[model samples]
Target: MANTAVRVRLTRGASEGDVAALKAWLERERKLEALRSSGELEIQERAGTQDGQGQARPMGAGLDIMLVLIGAAAPKLFDEVYEQVKSGVRAWRENRRDVENGEPPEVEVAPDGDGR
Candidate 1:
Protein backbone atom coordinates (compact mmCIF):
# COMPACT_ATOMS: atom_id res chain seq x y z
CA MET A 1 0.00 0.00 0.00
CA ALA A 2 1.06 3.58 -0.60
CA ASN A 3 2.14 5.64 2.42
CA THR A 4 2.22 9.26 3.55
CA ALA A 5 3.48 11.15 6.57
CA VAL A 6 1.67 13.91 8.46
CA ARG A 7 3.84 16.32 10.39
CA VAL A 8 2.27 18.01 13.41
CA ARG A 9 4.30 21.00 14.52
CA LEU A 10 3.47 22.31 17.96
CA THR A 11 3.90 25.85 19.25
CA ARG A 12 6.13 24.76 22.11
CA GLY A 13 8.43 21.97 23.12
CA ALA A 14 6.62 18.96 24.49
CA SER A 15 7.78 17.14 27.56
CA GLU A 16 8.30 13.39 27.66
CA GLY A 17 5.04 12.94 29.52
CA ASP A 18 3.24 14.94 26.90
CA VAL A 19 4.64 12.75 24.16
CA ALA A 20 3.62 9.66 26.09
CA ALA A 21 0.12 10.99 26.50
CA LEU A 22 -0.12 11.59 22.77
CA LYS A 23 1.20 8.09 22.10
CA ALA A 24 -1.41 6.61 24.40
CA TRP A 25 -4.14 8.57 22.68
CA LEU A 26 -3.04 7.38 19.29
CA GLU A 27 -2.81 3.80 20.53
CA ARG A 28 -6.42 4.02 21.60
CA GLU A 29 -7.56 5.08 18.17
CA ARG A 30 -8.75 1.63 17.15
CA LYS A 31 -10.08 2.83 13.82
CA LEU A 32 -6.52 3.57 12.81
CA GLU A 33 -5.24 0.17 13.85
CA ALA A 34 -4.64 -0.89 10.29
CA LEU A 35 -2.20 1.94 9.81
CA ARG A 36 -0.52 1.22 13.12
CA SER A 37 -0.13 -2.46 12.42
CA SER A 38 1.41 -1.73 9.09
CA GLY A 39 4.03 0.34 10.91
CA GLU A 40 2.74 3.59 9.47
CA LEU A 41 1.75 5.41 12.64
CA GLU A 42 4.56 7.14 14.49
CA ILE A 43 5.13 10.08 16.83
CA GLN A 44 8.34 11.87 17.71
CA GLU A 45 9.74 14.92 19.48
CA ARG A 46 12.10 17.41 17.89
CA ALA A 47 14.37 19.22 20.26
CA GLY A 48 15.42 22.83 19.81
CA THR A 49 18.63 23.61 18.00
CA GLN A 50 21.75 25.22 19.42
CA ASP A 51 23.00 28.52 18.08
CA GLY A 52 26.22 28.84 16.11
CA GLN A 53 27.87 30.52 19.08
CA GLY A 54 27.32 27.29 21.07
CA GLN A 55 24.81 29.03 23.25
CA ALA A 56 21.44 27.41 23.91
CA ARG A 57 18.66 28.78 21.77
CA PRO A 58 14.95 28.38 21.31
CA MET A 59 14.74 29.17 17.62
CA GLY A 60 11.99 27.21 15.95
CA ALA A 61 11.33 25.90 19.41
CA GLY A 62 7.66 26.07 18.59
CA LEU A 63 7.95 23.50 15.84
CA ASP A 64 8.68 20.79 18.33
CA ILE A 65 6.40 17.79 18.18
CA MET A 66 6.08 15.80 14.98
CA LEU A 67 3.70 12.99 14.02
CA VAL A 68 4.44 10.65 11.13
CA LEU A 69 1.85 8.51 9.42
CA ILE A 70 2.25 5.97 6.69
CA GLY A 71 0.08 3.69 4.52
CA ALA A 72 -2.39 4.22 1.72
CA ALA A 73 -5.11 5.20 4.19
CA ALA A 74 -3.06 8.00 5.70
CA PRO A 75 -4.40 10.70 3.38
CA LYS A 76 -7.98 10.05 4.34
CA LEU A 77 -7.12 9.66 8.01
CA PHE A 78 -4.96 12.75 8.38
CA ASP A 79 -7.65 15.17 9.52
CA GLU A 80 -8.96 12.99 12.32
CA VAL A 81 -5.50 12.23 13.66
CA TYR A 82 -4.41 15.83 13.33
CA GLU A 83 -7.37 17.08 15.37
CA GLN A 84 -6.85 14.55 18.10
CA VAL A 85 -3.12 15.25 18.35
CA LYS A 86 -3.64 19.00 18.30
CA SER A 87 -6.19 18.72 21.08
CA GLY A 88 -3.77 16.67 23.10
CA VAL A 89 -0.96 19.19 22.57
CA ARG A 90 -3.17 22.07 23.64
CA ALA A 91 -4.07 20.30 26.82
CA TRP A 92 -0.44 19.49 27.46
CA ARG A 93 0.67 23.07 26.95
CA GLU A 94 -1.92 24.61 29.22
CA ASN A 95 -0.03 23.67 32.36
CA ARG A 96 3.41 24.71 31.19
CA ARG A 97 4.76 28.12 32.19
CA ASP A 98 6.70 28.28 28.94
CA VAL A 99 3.47 28.50 27.03
CA GLU A 100 2.60 32.16 26.45
CA ASN A 101 0.04 33.45 28.99
CA GLY A 102 -1.17 29.88 29.42
CA GLU A 103 -2.81 30.01 26.04
CA PRO A 104 -3.55 26.81 24.22
CA PRO A 105 -0.72 25.63 22.00
CA GLU A 106 -1.07 26.30 18.30
CA VAL A 107 -0.52 23.39 15.97
CA GLU A 108 0.36 23.22 12.29
CA VAL A 109 -0.20 20.05 10.30
CA ALA A 110 1.69 19.52 7.09
CA PRO A 111 3.13 16.85 4.85
CA ASP A 112 6.37 15.23 6.10
CA GLY A 113 8.59 15.34 3.09
CA ASP A 114 12.01 13.61 2.87
CA GLY A 115 10.80 11.30 5.64
CA ARG A 116 13.31 12.74 8.09
Candidate 2:
Protein backbone atom coordinates (compact mmCIF):
# COMPACT_ATOMS: atom_id res chain seq x y z
CA MET A 1 0.00 0.00 0.00
CA ALA A 2 1.04 3.58 -0.48
CA ASN A 3 2.43 5.59 2.42
CA THR A 4 -0.55 7.92 2.27
CA ALA A 5 -3.87 7.37 3.94
CA VAL A 6 -6.83 5.70 2.29
CA ARG A 7 -10.33 7.11 2.55
CA VAL A 8 -13.46 5.05 2.29
CA ARG A 9 -16.81 6.79 2.08
CA LEU A 10 -20.41 5.61 2.03
CA THR A 11 -23.14 7.52 0.29
CA ARG A 12 -26.79 6.92 -0.42
CA GLY A 13 -29.89 8.73 -1.52
CA ALA A 14 -30.37 10.31 1.88
CA SER A 15 -31.75 13.11 3.93
CA GLU A 16 -29.53 14.80 6.49
CA GLY A 17 -31.11 12.73 9.23
CA ASP A 18 -30.50 9.55 7.27
CA VAL A 19 -26.84 10.35 7.00
CA ALA A 20 -26.58 10.87 10.73
CA ALA A 21 -28.42 7.66 11.39
CA LEU A 22 -26.13 5.73 9.07
CA LYS A 23 -23.07 7.11 10.81
CA ALA A 24 -24.44 6.08 14.17
CA TRP A 25 -25.29 2.67 12.85
CA LEU A 26 -21.80 2.11 11.52
CA GLU A 27 -20.27 3.22 14.78
CA ARG A 28 -22.11 0.45 16.55
CA GLU A 29 -20.24 -2.26 14.71
CA ARG A 30 -17.93 -4.11 17.08
CA LYS A 31 -15.02 -4.45 14.70
CA LEU A 32 -15.25 -0.84 13.57
CA GLU A 33 -15.42 0.37 17.13
CA ALA A 34 -12.37 -1.60 18.06
CA LEU A 35 -10.44 -0.31 15.07
CA ARG A 36 -11.41 3.24 15.97
CA SER A 37 -10.40 2.75 19.58
CA SER A 38 -7.01 1.61 18.37
CA GLY A 39 -6.55 4.68 16.14
CA GLU A 40 -6.54 2.67 12.95
CA LEU A 41 -9.67 4.31 11.61
CA GLU A 42 -11.08 7.81 11.65
CA ILE A 43 -14.65 8.85 10.96
CA GLN A 44 -15.54 12.26 9.58
CA GLU A 45 -18.66 14.16 8.70
CA ARG A 46 -19.06 16.07 5.48
CA ALA A 47 -21.05 19.22 5.83
CA GLY A 48 -21.91 22.35 3.93
CA THR A 49 -21.73 25.96 5.03
CA GLN A 50 -24.90 27.56 6.33
CA ASP A 51 -26.18 30.38 4.19
CA GLY A 52 -25.84 33.23 6.65
CA GLN A 53 -23.76 32.23 9.68
CA GLY A 54 -21.12 30.41 7.62
CA GLN A 55 -21.41 27.48 9.97
CA ALA A 56 -20.98 23.91 8.86
CA ARG A 57 -24.20 21.94 8.55
CA PRO A 58 -25.02 18.53 7.17
CA MET A 59 -26.52 18.37 3.71
CA GLY A 60 -28.46 15.47 2.34
CA ALA A 61 -27.31 15.37 -1.25
CA GLY A 62 -23.61 14.95 -0.66
CA LEU A 63 -23.48 13.99 2.96
CA ASP A 64 -21.18 11.03 3.42
CA ILE A 65 -19.77 8.72 6.06
CA MET A 66 -16.01 8.72 5.61
CA LEU A 67 -13.42 6.40 7.09
CA VAL A 68 -9.76 7.32 7.00
CA LEU A 69 -7.12 4.63 7.36
CA ILE A 70 -4.17 5.99 9.30
CA GLY A 71 -2.30 3.20 10.97
CA ALA A 72 0.42 0.84 9.82
CA ALA A 73 -1.95 -2.10 10.15
CA ALA A 74 -4.49 -0.49 7.83
CA PRO A 75 -3.71 -2.79 4.89
CA LYS A 76 -4.70 -5.86 6.84
CA LEU A 77 -7.46 -4.09 8.71
CA PHE A 78 -8.90 -2.62 5.51
CA ASP A 79 -10.89 -5.70 4.54
CA GLU A 80 -12.43 -5.99 7.98
CA VAL A 81 -13.42 -2.36 7.99
CA TYR A 82 -14.79 -2.51 4.45
CA GLU A 83 -16.95 -5.51 5.28
CA GLN A 84 -18.33 -3.90 8.40
CA VAL A 85 -19.14 -0.73 6.53
CA LYS A 86 -20.79 -2.66 3.76
CA SER A 87 -22.95 -4.48 6.27
CA GLY A 88 -23.96 -1.24 7.86
CA VAL A 89 -24.97 0.25 4.52
CA ARG A 90 -26.92 -2.87 3.67
CA ALA A 91 -28.81 -2.72 6.94
CA TRP A 92 -29.50 0.96 6.56
CA ARG A 93 -30.80 0.58 3.03
CA GLU A 94 -33.03 -2.34 3.94
CA ASN A 95 -34.85 -0.16 6.44
CA ARG A 96 -35.64 2.64 4.05
CA ARG A 97 -39.12 2.66 2.57
CA ASP A 98 -37.98 4.53 -0.53
CA VAL A 99 -35.02 2.40 -1.33
CA GLU A 100 -36.00 2.36 -4.96
CA ASN A 101 -36.63 6.06 -5.31
CA GLY A 102 -33.12 7.12 -6.11
CA GLU A 103 -29.60 5.94 -6.71
CA PRO A 104 -28.51 3.01 -4.61
CA PRO A 105 -26.09 3.41 -1.73
CA GLU A 106 -22.41 3.13 -2.64
CA VAL A 107 -19.01 2.85 -1.02
CA GLU A 108 -15.91 4.46 -2.49
CA VAL A 109 -12.33 3.66 -1.55
CA ALA A 110 -9.72 6.14 -2.70
CA PRO A 111 -6.49 7.81 -1.76
CA ASP A 112 -6.95 10.36 1.00
CA GLY A 113 -6.56 13.55 -0.97
CA ASP A 114 -6.99 17.10 0.35
CA GLY A 115 -9.65 15.88 2.76
CA ARG A 116 -12.53 16.02 0.20
Candidate 3:
Protein backbone atom coordinates (compact mmCIF):
# COMPACT_ATOMS: atom_id res chain seq x y z
CA MET A 1 0.00 0.00 0.00
CA ALA A 2 3.01 2.27 -0.03
CA ASN A 3 5.74 3.28 -2.47
CA THR A 4 9.22 4.77 -2.35
CA ALA A 5 11.58 6.72 -4.55
CA VAL A 6 15.32 7.02 -4.92
CA ARG A 7 17.02 10.03 -6.47
CA VAL A 8 20.61 9.74 -7.58
CA ARG A 9 22.82 12.34 -9.25
CA LEU A 10 26.10 11.23 -10.66
CA THR A 11 28.23 14.25 -9.82
CA ARG A 12 30.61 13.24 -12.58
CA GLY A 13 30.99 10.85 -15.56
CA ALA A 14 27.30 10.31 -16.39
CA SER A 15 25.40 11.55 -19.40
CA GLU A 16 21.74 12.58 -19.43
CA GLY A 17 20.42 9.46 -21.17
CA ASP A 18 22.60 7.15 -19.10
CA VAL A 19 21.44 8.68 -15.85
CA ALA A 20 17.82 8.64 -16.94
CA ALA A 21 17.75 5.04 -18.13
CA LEU A 22 19.87 3.81 -15.23
CA LYS A 23 17.65 5.53 -12.70
CA ALA A 24 14.48 4.08 -14.19
CA TRP A 25 15.91 0.57 -14.44
CA LEU A 26 17.32 0.68 -10.92
CA GLU A 27 14.09 1.99 -9.47
CA ARG A 28 11.95 -0.71 -11.04
CA GLU A 29 14.36 -3.48 -10.14
CA ARG A 30 14.52 -2.26 -6.58
CA LYS A 31 10.76 -1.85 -6.31
CA LEU A 32 9.86 -5.16 -7.88
CA GLU A 33 12.45 -6.98 -5.79
CA ALA A 34 11.18 -5.30 -2.67
CA LEU A 35 7.60 -6.15 -3.46
CA ARG A 36 8.40 -9.75 -4.27
CA SER A 37 10.52 -10.10 -1.16
CA SER A 38 7.68 -8.63 0.92
CA GLY A 39 5.09 -10.81 -0.84
CA GLU A 40 3.15 -7.92 -2.34
CA LEU A 41 3.14 -8.57 -6.08
CA GLU A 42 -0.03 -10.43 -6.91
CA ILE A 43 -0.19 -12.44 -10.13
CA GLN A 44 -3.91 -12.12 -10.95
CA GLU A 45 -3.64 -8.96 -12.98
CA ARG A 46 -3.88 -10.78 -16.29
CA ALA A 47 -6.58 -13.17 -15.23
CA GLY A 48 -9.55 -10.97 -16.13
CA THR A 49 -8.11 -9.30 -19.19
CA GLN A 50 -10.25 -9.81 -22.33
CA ASP A 51 -7.41 -9.60 -24.86
CA GLY A 52 -4.25 -9.85 -22.79
CA GLN A 53 -4.52 -6.41 -21.22
CA GLY A 54 -4.31 -6.31 -17.46
CA GLN A 55 -4.49 -4.19 -14.38
CA ALA A 56 -2.51 -1.04 -13.99
CA ARG A 57 1.16 -1.37 -13.16
CA PRO A 58 2.97 0.43 -10.38
CA MET A 59 5.05 3.59 -10.85
CA GLY A 60 5.73 5.66 -13.95
CA ALA A 61 8.23 4.40 -16.52
CA GLY A 62 10.57 7.26 -17.32
CA LEU A 63 13.15 9.58 -15.83
CA ASP A 64 11.88 12.24 -13.48
CA ILE A 65 14.94 14.45 -13.57
CA MET A 66 16.13 16.78 -16.31
CA LEU A 67 19.04 15.45 -18.39
CA VAL A 68 20.74 18.40 -19.93
CA LEU A 69 24.35 18.06 -20.96
CA ILE A 70 26.79 20.58 -19.62
CA GLY A 71 26.93 23.11 -22.39
CA ALA A 72 30.46 24.14 -21.51
CA ALA A 73 31.80 20.61 -21.40
CA ALA A 74 33.71 19.07 -24.26
CA PRO A 75 31.78 17.93 -27.34
CA LYS A 76 32.56 14.22 -26.78
CA LEU A 77 30.44 14.07 -23.67
CA PHE A 78 28.72 10.77 -24.48
CA ASP A 79 31.95 9.02 -25.33
CA GLU A 80 33.52 10.29 -22.14
CA VAL A 81 30.85 8.76 -19.94
CA TYR A 82 30.89 5.48 -21.84
CA GLU A 83 34.68 5.18 -21.57
CA GLN A 84 34.64 6.10 -17.91
CA VAL A 85 32.19 3.38 -16.99
CA LYS A 86 33.94 0.83 -19.17
CA SER A 87 37.31 1.68 -17.69
CA GLY A 88 35.97 1.54 -14.17
CA VAL A 89 34.55 -1.91 -14.75
CA ARG A 90 37.80 -3.03 -16.33
CA ALA A 91 39.87 -1.74 -13.44
CA TRP A 92 37.61 -3.43 -10.94
CA ARG A 93 38.03 -6.74 -12.72
CA GLU A 94 41.79 -6.27 -12.89
CA ASN A 95 41.89 -5.54 -9.19
CA ARG A 96 39.89 -8.66 -8.48
CA ARG A 97 42.22 -10.68 -10.66
CA ASP A 98 45.19 -9.29 -8.81
CA VAL A 99 43.66 -10.21 -5.50
CA GLU A 100 42.82 -13.72 -6.65
CA ASN A 101 46.37 -14.16 -7.92
CA GLY A 102 47.76 -13.47 -4.42
CA GLU A 103 49.00 -10.06 -5.46
CA PRO A 104 48.15 -6.55 -4.30
CA PRO A 105 44.91 -5.17 -5.71
CA GLU A 106 45.62 -2.52 -8.33
CA VAL A 107 43.22 -0.42 -10.41
CA GLU A 108 44.23 1.19 -13.67
CA VAL A 109 42.68 1.70 -17.13
CA ALA A 110 44.39 2.76 -20.32
CA PRO A 111 42.60 4.61 -23.06
CA ASP A 112 41.70 2.70 -26.28
CA GLY A 113 42.43 5.77 -28.43
CA ASP A 114 39.43 7.55 -26.92
CA GLY A 115 40.35 10.12 -24.26
CA ARG A 116 39.87 8.92 -20.72
Candidate 4:
Protein backbone atom coordinates (compact mmCIF):
# COMPACT_ATOMS: atom_id res chain seq x y z
CA MET A 1 0.00 0.00 0.00
CA ALA A 2 1.47 3.33 -1.06
CA ASN A 3 1.72 6.22 1.37
CA THR A 4 -1.27 8.49 1.05
CA ALA A 5 -2.27 11.71 2.75
CA VAL A 6 -4.27 10.99 5.88
CA ARG A 7 -6.79 13.39 7.43
CA VAL A 8 -4.75 14.23 10.50
CA ARG A 9 -3.98 17.49 12.26
CA LEU A 10 -0.53 18.42 13.49
CA THR A 11 0.41 17.71 17.08
CA ARG A 12 0.81 20.42 19.74
CA GLY A 13 4.26 21.21 18.47
CA ALA A 14 3.04 21.60 14.88
CA SER A 15 2.57 24.99 13.39
CA GLU A 16 -0.73 25.67 11.65
CA GLY A 17 0.77 28.26 9.34
CA ASP A 18 3.47 25.83 8.28
CA VAL A 19 1.02 23.14 7.31
CA ALA A 20 -1.01 25.63 5.33
CA ALA A 21 2.09 26.73 3.50
CA LEU A 22 2.97 23.17 2.47
CA LYS A 23 -0.46 22.59 0.95
CA ALA A 24 -0.19 25.77 -1.03
CA TRP A 25 3.20 24.66 -2.27
CA LEU A 26 2.05 21.19 -3.36
CA GLU A 27 -0.90 22.68 -5.20
CA ARG A 28 1.36 24.93 -7.19
CA GLU A 29 4.09 22.31 -7.60
CA ARG A 30 1.43 20.16 -9.32
CA LYS A 31 2.16 17.39 -6.84
CA LEU A 32 -1.41 17.46 -5.67
CA GLU A 33 -2.81 16.38 -9.03
CA ALA A 34 -0.40 13.51 -9.29
CA LEU A 35 -1.23 12.28 -5.80
CA ARG A 36 -4.92 12.39 -6.59
CA SER A 37 -4.43 10.31 -9.73
CA SER A 38 -2.31 7.81 -7.82
CA GLY A 39 -5.01 7.47 -5.17
CA GLU A 40 -2.64 8.85 -2.56
CA LEU A 41 -4.27 12.21 -2.07
CA GLU A 42 -7.54 11.07 -0.58
CA ILE A 43 -6.56 8.57 2.07
CA GLN A 44 -5.83 10.64 5.15
CA GLU A 45 -6.47 9.25 8.64
CA ARG A 46 -5.64 11.84 11.27
CA ALA A 47 -4.31 10.88 14.66
CA GLY A 48 -5.44 12.11 18.07
CA THR A 49 -4.39 15.32 19.87
CA GLN A 50 -4.25 16.78 23.41
CA ASP A 51 -5.46 20.36 22.82
CA GLY A 52 -8.92 18.97 22.18
CA GLN A 53 -9.05 21.01 19.00
CA GLY A 54 -6.86 19.16 16.54
CA GLN A 55 -9.50 18.31 14.01
CA ALA A 56 -9.83 21.64 12.27
CA ARG A 57 -7.17 21.44 9.58
CA PRO A 58 -6.30 18.34 7.59
CA MET A 59 -2.58 17.47 8.10
CA GLY A 60 -0.77 14.99 5.90
CA ALA A 61 1.50 14.84 2.84
CA GLY A 62 2.07 13.17 -0.53
CA LEU A 63 1.45 13.50 -4.25
CA ASP A 64 -1.01 16.12 -5.45
CA ILE A 65 -2.94 17.03 -2.34
CA MET A 66 -2.13 18.25 1.20
CA LEU A 67 -4.20 17.42 4.25
CA VAL A 68 -4.44 19.25 7.58
CA LEU A 69 -6.71 17.84 10.29
CA ILE A 70 -7.02 21.28 11.90
CA GLY A 71 -5.31 20.03 15.06
CA ALA A 72 -4.17 16.14 15.15
CA ALA A 73 -0.68 15.85 13.68
CA ALA A 74 2.72 16.30 15.21
CA PRO A 75 3.90 19.91 15.29
CA LYS A 76 7.29 19.14 13.87
CA LEU A 77 5.92 17.28 10.87
CA PHE A 78 3.25 19.86 10.25
CA ASP A 79 5.80 22.70 10.17
CA GLU A 80 8.00 20.85 7.75
CA VAL A 81 5.29 20.36 5.13
CA TYR A 82 3.67 23.72 5.83
CA GLU A 83 6.77 25.52 4.57
CA GLN A 84 6.21 23.81 1.25
CA VAL A 85 2.60 24.93 1.18
CA LYS A 86 3.59 28.51 1.96
CA SER A 87 5.95 28.50 -0.98
CA GLY A 88 3.21 27.35 -3.29
CA VAL A 89 0.81 29.93 -1.97
CA ARG A 90 3.32 32.68 -2.64
CA ALA A 91 3.76 31.47 -6.18
CA TRP A 92 0.03 31.40 -6.80
CA ARG A 93 -0.65 34.82 -5.32
CA GLU A 94 2.20 36.29 -7.30
CA ASN A 95 0.88 34.90 -10.58
CA ARG A 96 -2.75 35.71 -9.91
CA ARG A 97 -2.88 39.18 -8.37
CA ASP A 98 -6.63 39.44 -8.63
CA VAL A 99 -7.28 36.24 -6.73
CA GLU A 100 -8.28 36.69 -3.14
CA ASN A 101 -8.91 34.07 -0.45
CA GLY A 102 -10.94 34.96 2.58
CA GLU A 103 -10.85 32.09 5.02
CA PRO A 104 -13.73 32.20 7.47
CA PRO A 105 -12.98 32.21 11.18
CA GLU A 106 -13.27 28.71 12.59
CA VAL A 107 -12.05 29.07 16.16
CA GLU A 108 -12.89 31.55 18.86
CA VAL A 109 -9.86 32.54 20.86
CA ALA A 110 -10.80 34.40 24.00
CA PRO A 111 -8.65 34.84 27.06
CA ASP A 112 -10.14 34.38 30.47
CA GLY A 113 -10.81 37.54 32.49
CA ASP A 114 -7.92 38.29 34.78
CA GLY A 115 -8.19 41.65 36.43
CA ARG A 116 -4.77 42.59 37.63
Q: Which candidate has the top score in TM-score?
A: 2
lDDT of 4 by residue, 38-61 (tens): 543332222333233534434422
Model 3 earns a TM-score of: 0.23
Our model 4 lands, by Cα RMSD against the true structure, at: 13.5
lDDT of 2 at 32: 78
Give me the candidate number with maximum lDDT. Answer: 2
Q: After superposition, how far is residue 52 of candidate 1 from its true place, in Å?
A: 19
Off by over 4 Å in 4: 1-28, 43-81, 98-116
How do these models rank on lDDT, best leading? 2, 1, 4, 3
C-alpha RMSD of each candidate structure in angstroms:
6.3, 6.5, 19.0, 13.5
Q: What's the distance in Å from true for residue 28, model 3? A: 25
Per-residue lDDT tens digits for candidate 2, residues 1-116, read 33233343444444666667777877777887887888777777764333223355344445545676675676666666666777767776676536556554564544443433
lDDT of 2 at 9: 47
RMSD of 2: 6.5
Per-model TM against the reference = 0.48, 0.63, 0.23, 0.29
Which pairs clash inside model 1? none
lDDT of 3 at 105: 23
Clashes of each: 0, 0, 0, 41
